[model samples]
Target: MAERVWEPGDRLPSRAQIGQEYGVGENVVRRAQELLISQGVLEGRAGSGTYVAEPRERVRVVRSSARQRVRVVRSSAREQPSGSPFRADMNAVGRRGVWESRTAAKVPAPAEIAARLGITEGELCVRTTYEFLADGKPVQLSASWEPYDLIAGSLVVLPEGGPHAWAGVVNRMAAIGVTVSHAVEQPEPRMATAEEASLLGIQKAALVTHIRRTYYSDQGRPVETADIVVPAAHCEIVYEIPINR
Candidate 1:
């Protein structure tokens, strides 16, 4: 790719052929191709072949602690028509941002999620899964969980279907009288799972950034927890912290 030997959209030779040409094992060629694909240098087409990918700008995800908001931002001045922060972010970058979400109530919390939310396993919680897209291309995924008891009998119980529908976690919790103090996020690099790869249109085992985020109230009580996933090749995460004088 550096030398333009394989131009954008140009199909690469078969693994066997590449291995023979370089006098390496086919497994080596396959591994190298996978790495390049994960880095956005190449893309694999099922039942077709691997091809050099077009240059793409990474989406910027801005997490601002000063305002207690997580949003995507770009330098452009255009504004989105919708009220969603994600849409505003896409509009800034000259793309359309849309998402599909499904919410399930009374879902049993798994061990890991229970730990994050400070609840015991088998506790009932409301879970919402989101698939976010930019310009019709999948870019991110999120699974959010909140204890049922926290907002029981409230209008914000169904995150996407209530009066406060589509309102962010902070706003929703605030409406229920929970003053969200802050959020903590831990990010780690890992390989993608089969389900994630299919949903994001990436190769299985591709590199990705996984984040575990939890929102806490003024009393340090966990109100909500979420797992966010971003394709490493398609997005960049930025943290903006405010320094008090």
Candidate 2:
């Protein structure tokens, strides 16, 4: 193994040489080499043979529930002072802080999204798009969809350049006599689409992490469903589990 740490792009010794050096059978040497190749630690070229692979950048994972606390501010330019949206102080924090912004749109949900949200095709949903940034760089984009009937009268439009806080929104809704019970999240990985690449500032070759979360009201009715897309390089997802004895 020590001898196998060849420089990136450097050809590895032939199987015969490896077997002779390690005093192992040819089949044993071949099996060992094959295992390494499968792990991305080695690269094999058709004619050039196997070589050491260059180390790739490590992806950082951040759990949404583990987000750092941020100060909230009220947005200006409210038509009604009572309906002003809350904003966060961007200048007071560094790039590590997650800055969120939201906008509402009326659109048809995609098939996969609709299935996840348990909605019928062509159903009109109130789409809430969230842009999550770190140090002014967009790291993720999420779109939440809810049956318009549920949130139509309760929707509060944010002022220009307002900050986004999901917890705050939940709290406000509760104050209005709406009870939120729990949230469920489903996650997976997929290749980034062209539009996703443009929005996330990542290359098409990079993969993206997709998470769909549904929030249910206390009455066991689904209230909101969100689809979150994050660049593999900039973010990570973590889950904590506890065992009961």
Candidate 3:
């Protein structure tokens, strides 16, 4: 690609062919392609073949809010999308953004999720998985969990259903008379799992930023928790903190 042998949008040689030319095994060629794919240098199309990917500028994700106040406050910035943070970030970069989500009711929480929600193992919860896209390319993924007992039979039970469909966690909880106090977020850098890489169109073990965030109600009860994942090569994270003298 450096020598323009495979320009952007150019289909690459098959693994067998590349291996023969390079005097390496097909597996070696495949692994090299996977690494390049993870670095945004190539893209794989199922039933087709791999191609050099177009260069993409990294989008900036600004996590800004006025949570220092007694109540958690959404950013007043007009740039902040009321519905989805993914949209906000994409908008900042002048790209169209959208997301797809699936919600499952009464799903049993795993031990790790249960601990995060302060619930017993095997307890039921609502799990919603999201895939966020920018210009039709997958850029982020998330799995959100909410305690079933808190929202059972409510109009907001299905996060993407009902009158409040697409409303975020804060607004959905607010509709049920729960006031969110603040959220705790822990961000860590890690290698992507196979599933994550596949979903995000990256290679296995690709670098990603994972954030574990939980929203707490005014009474200090955990309202919602989520695992947010973003491809490190596709986006940069920024924090906006407000200060008062």
Candidate 4:
């Protein structure tokens, strides 16, 4: 006989009753019940038996099809007047200061990541991971990798629990004779991983935006490569293009 569908809050049959009804051993019935619980299809309440749980909506990762327009804004009267492209709408929550709690030992770069960085297998590199929070809630997780020979001891240090401009690192690097000329960004839709979900305080199945950006120096060398993962609901990225003669 087909098992009856149970709705949310519906009381489930006792284990013994279910085993008897199915003409199966208690161990078999218990195993079936455990499977349901692990899948979030059933819940056990204190002082009560197991019950059906409301099904959760499946997370959807949708890439934005709209093209972002960049705008030019004047900085100040004293400075050489130049227009800067800015995003039309960004998340309202401000960054919750840079927290520099270094994560433990570095691991081998994943295949996809290694290709993007143009690094060889088993090469040593320094990895820095950052969690960006808004109002004490994580919204983005960023990981940056640099070859040990290039940025071993001279990396610009971020202040602990203090706010830094999003472009601060690039500017600082320029001051030290590294001229950053251009950047390339790749954005895509992806489901959140377990660690990503926990860091962003979101459901494991939640949709997220994955962005990879590589900044290059005037000398044609890669200066920095950043991988950013953000919650879909919390961010809208804008890019501006200017028609030049």
Best by lDDT: 1
Please give each candidate's TM-score.
Answer: 0.87, 0.57, 0.74, 0.54
Comparison by lDDT, 3 against 4, better one: 3
TM-score for candidate 1: 0.87
lDDT against the true structure, each candidate: 0.84, 0.60, 0.83, 0.57
Shift in Å, residue 190, candidate 1: 1.4
After superposition, which runs of candidate 1 have C-alpha atoms over 4 Å from their true positions? 1-4, 66-85
Q: Residues 76-125, candidate 1, lDDT per residue (tens digit)?
A: 76421233546656666788788999999999999999998899999999
- Looking at model 4, report the run of 10 residues with the lowest lDDT sum: 80-89
**Candidate 2: residue 4 lDDT (0-100):** 48
Query: How many residue pairs clash in each candidate at the backbone level?
Result: 0, 3, 0, 1
Q: Give a tens-digit lDDT track for model 3, residues 110-143.
A: 9999999999989999999999888898988999
lDDT of 2 by residue, 93-165 (tens): 3334354656554567778667766777677676767776666677678777776655555533331223322
Encode model 4's per-residue lDDT on 51-169: one tens digit a residue.
88776432222222122222233456432211111111222122223333454234566666666667765555656677764445565677876544454445343311122223333
Candidate 2 is scored at a TM of: 0.57
Residue 178, candidate 3: C-alpha displacement in angstroms:
0.6
Q: Could you tell me the lDDT of residue 48 within candidate 3?
A: 93
Q: Where is model 2 more than 4 Å wrong at Cα?
A: 1-102, 155-169, 240-245
